[model samples]
Target: MSDDVRNIDDALSRITAYWQPHRLTSINDYDVKVVKIHGEFVWHDHPDTDELFMVLNGELIIQLRDRDVVLGPNDVFVVPRGVEHRPKADEEVHALLFEPKGTVNTGSAGGEMTSPLRELP
Candidate 1:
């Protein structure tokens, strides 16, 4: 993407991998990412930074230690720092994540599913 206005939906459509996030852009200390995912993700938390999940398509359910927050297109939710949370989807869901630049996808729970930081095309 160029150093200009970006359309989130347009950026997401270029992704072909499930659960892999493409960095859309950076805002100060935060990075905006677009990911395509299906099924459940591991429970994790960023101890030092909050994470924002914004659904652009399909449905998503964020499973918190206490309760579940369901989301659909255009919905947004923020997971506070140090809060354990897991995200799941019954079908292919497209979403955008906002968090610090170095925040890992798996947070404290490292595994094979964790992907390296990516760049947007």
Candidate 2:
């Protein structure tokens, strides 16, 4: 898609699968992505890139090595590079992610939650 206004709610509504990230747009060397998720994600660390997680719906708890950060709708948290963490939710949550292009969902600790990049819905 070309540069244009985007409604994250509308974009999030179109997602059909959990944990599958759909790239919404790109800026410079980063890609903006949205995904639907629930439960706990694998513990991983992006050694070279920080990850932004912005909650669009529901709630999420980012479990860090030292503590947990709780996020609700409209909340945003940045997990620093090389900081091991895991995301967990009791119910389904919709969220946006901003990180460098090619930053995997599971980071360097690849696991079942690792997702292939997908075109925007």
Candidate 3:
């Protein structure tokens, strides 16, 4: 991390791929990342850590085992560790994720949607 000022929207605009997270910075052992997502994501859970999701644009539905949590712009939600969850979006969504460093996009049920964190330039 540097003493640099970055525009979130401008940085988000450069992210061309969906469900792919671009690292913005790091604090302690966690990373702050931005991602563009559309369609439905794979159902999975981080066994070792809780995942935080903050919707930057559009709406998102976090599907949990018992119920679904709907999130709107500027909304924040944390899926507790070991909880099975799947994120679904009918349209495109811009969001930020805060999790431990090297947390894979796809957690335990890793499949095609898994992605290594992409660092911002």
> Considering every candidate listed, which one attains the maximal TM-score?
3
The TM-scores of all predictions, comma-separated, are 0.93, 0.93, 0.96
- The root-mean-square deviation over C-alpha atoms between each candidate and the true structure, in angstroms, is 1.4, 1.2, 0.9
lDDT of 1 by residue, 68-96 (tens): 99999999999999999999999999999
lDDT of 1 at 6: 82
Which candidate tops lDDT? 3
Clashing residue pairs, backbone N/CA/C < 3 A, model 1: none
Tell me which residue pairs clash in candidate 2.
none
lDDT of 3 by residue, 50-105 (tens): 99999998999999989999999999999999999999899999999999998999
lDDT of 1 at 9: 78
lDDT per residue for candidate 2 within 1-121, as digits (tens), equals 5468888878888899888898988889999999998989999999999999999889999999899999999999999999999999999999999989898899999977889988875
Candidate 3 residue spans exceeding 4 A from truth: none
